[model samples]
Target: MLWWVLGGAALLVVAVVVTGVVLFVVAAGKSDRVWGVDDVAVGECVTVSGEDEPVVRKVSCDSTDFHFAVALKADPGVCAAKNYSRLWFGEGDSSDSFGKWARDGLCLAHVYQQGRCYHLPSSKETNALADVREIDCSSPPATGAGENYEVESKVSGMPECSEEQAEYFTEKPTPTGYCLRLLE
Candidate 1:
């Protein structure tokens, strides 16, 4: 009877240890924070504009560690009032498309620096876009460096292109109806 009791206690301890380890692993896999537009404020660092929830991050106004910075936040009603120019998202070449956008509606974003040296955005998907190095618009860009847009504006509907911003517009509009417009 004494041996049996010791055996049972050892088994119980082992089970408890295994359960604890499993719980810790699961918790670690999940992010501690999830951010949304409502969670951020003006002048905060942000993934360009999109509806898709980005892969769980802690967004803050004080930090510039992220991609594009938010100068203004707009909805379907107010987005048009703030934008000066627009470039259609997904107009980028086949090399630029990460994956066929498979599912989920898309969002458009354009980067604009003060010097007007914005580059073509590689992806419309906020979570998928990689290595975006946004800089302050007040400053000038390098003599022959890459693209950087300071303020990101999520536009409404397929934007009308003009000589002022872009020479052409998106051939493929987003299923959601709105496309990202950026400086050329």
Candidate 2:
């Protein structure tokens, strides 16, 4: 009924360097900056991960200009961005996984560059920096055309039935493995 829208490694003895990035970039500035999950620090914000080459458009963390702080990060051998989706959808597969609901609530609109688009964070931007650019989540976007949607708070992973505590608490998955929803 409300709004609309929405790691790393250290090679010791002999390091191996690989170069071939697949990225899907989005920026609030005239030019977007490249960054990855690893580049993101704990408590910092970042674009949600998905199949689309990881997008790492940096935003100022000091300000309320972004969503989803860098709750977790992974390296090449550990897992792929798709794993981010797995971790997200499967309610996270392990003890050390990141909590999907662990995020700032002042701005709860899950605006995926105006809509939830990307699913798995890509490998390309996995090595990029993500602590610089500033995109204000509170301010009206520059385009001012995209829509925003409602976000349910108590809704846990794929709830089968609605509860009195959370009548609108619903959970669904996108093909790529994320979600876009609104009872608004």
Best by TM-score: 1
* Residue-wise C-alpha lDDT for candidate 2, range 96-120, written one tens digit per residue: 2232222221111122332222221
List model 1 lDDT by residue over 1-184, tens digit each: 9999999999999999999999999997654342344554444344443343233243443443443334444432232344311111232333223432222122233232323233333344333444344544566355233344433222434544433343222222221112223422
Give lDDT: candidate 1, residue 2: 100
Off by over 4 Å in 2: 1-34, 48-52, 62-66, 75-149, 152-181
Q: How many collisions between residues are there in candidate 1?
A: 5
Give the number of the best model, judged by lDDT: 1
Candidate 1: stretches off by over 4 Å: 28-64, 67-96, 99-101, 108-128, 135-145, 149-184
Candidate 1 Cα lDDT to native = 0.38
TM-scores for the candidates? 0.35, 0.27
